[model samples]
Target chain A: AQSVTQPDARVTVSEGASLQLRCKYSYSGTPYLFWYVQYPRQGLQLLLKYYSGDPVVQGVNGFEAEFIKSNSSFHLRKASVHWSDSAVYFCAVMSNTGYQNFYFGKGTSLTVIP
Target chain B: EAGVTQSPRYAVLQEGQAVSFWCDPISGHDTLYWYQQPRDQGPQLLVYFRDEAVIDNSQLPSDRFSAVRPKGTNSTLKIQSAKQGDTATYLCASTPGTLYFGAGTRLSVL
Candidate 1:
């Protein structure tokens, strides 16, 4: 079964500080990875996705994630985070073959303190 | 284009009561999905359809839960008897390729 794991339940960082949210996935074959952000009282928004080449994928709002195949990890990073960046981040994985159902992680809640 | 839309932004129900959720996917999109998200947890897939045909509904609890996409445009999910464990936010999403999600309906069972 394909699954995603986000270790950190909550992360706190100061404004303008760098941020990195870790994610790990489990799948036998090739997997499609994604990062999504959910704000309070709103739906989730896709931040980035990794399908094939270019291990590093950039996303909206100055976010980026690197797909490390060997380690089975796709960690999200940002050079600097703003107060507005506070939200819950989810890591999802989709199988390349059969069903194509998305599996999500428990999510990491980020808090950017000013 | 308008994104996926879900009705009844919030629902409050007593145990044993019934509740229904409605979703309208993006125009021209053929696939629709339903997910359940518990407090502070990830979204779990319940069921999905492709143009009114159920692709997979293995995770759905058929005993008291039912879903339908009659015309392959709008969809509805109904729970016959609500339980405390059923309290969660119900999310609807659509995809042509990439997934687009609705604001979701927050459900609370007392």
Candidate 2:
């Protein structure tokens, strides 16, 4: 079964500090990977997606993710975290199971302190 | 120009009650998806449609849950009998190139 795993349930960091959210996926073949963020009282928004070619992809709001096929990981990273960036981050992988299914991680909640 | 739209931002019902959520996808989008997000959990796929045809619905609880995308545009998800375990946010998304989501309909079944 194709699945995404975000090991961290919650992470706290001081504003302006570097942030990294870890993600691991279980899939047999090459799958489409994505990072999504959900703010309070808002829908999930796409951050970035990786299909082929470059392993690192830039997303909106100064977010970026690198897909490492060997580790089966697609980790999200930010050089400087903003207070507004404090939200739940999810890692998703598009399944190749005939239907286009996006398997999502349970999500990691980030709390930024000023 | 508009994003995906979903109505009934919130719904509350007792066990055995019925509720229906509506969604209007982005104009010209052919693929629509419905997801259920419980508190502190990731969104799980419930069903999806390509145009007006059902592509996948294996995750949907057919005995109580039903979905339709008539005319390949607007869509609806109905729960014939709401359950306390069903308390979650129902999310609607459409895909043109990348997938975009609506704010979602939050449901609480007591």
Highest TM-score against the true fold, candidate: 1
Say which candidate scores most in DockQ. 1
The digit string of per-residue lDDT tens for model 1 on B1-110 reads: 89999999999999999999999999998989999999999999999999999999999999999999999999999999999999999999998667799999999999
TM-scores for candidates 1 onward, in order: 0.98, 0.97
Q: TM-scores for chain A, candidates in order? A: 0.98, 0.97
Q: For model 1 chain B, where is the 10-residue window of minimal lDDT?
A: B92-101
User: What is the lDDT, from 0 to 100, of the residue A83 in candidate 2?
Assistant: 94
TM-score for candidate 1: 0.98
Runs of candidate 2 exceeding 4 Å displacement:
A96-98
Task: Check candidate 1 and list the clashing pairs.
Answer: none
> Model 1: per-residue lDDT, tens digit, A1-114?
778999999999999999999999999988899999999988889999999999999999999999998999999999999999999999999877755678899999999999
**Deviation in Å, model 2, residue B34 alpha carbon:** 0.4
Q: What C-alpha lDDT does candidate 1 achieve relative to the native structure? A: 0.94
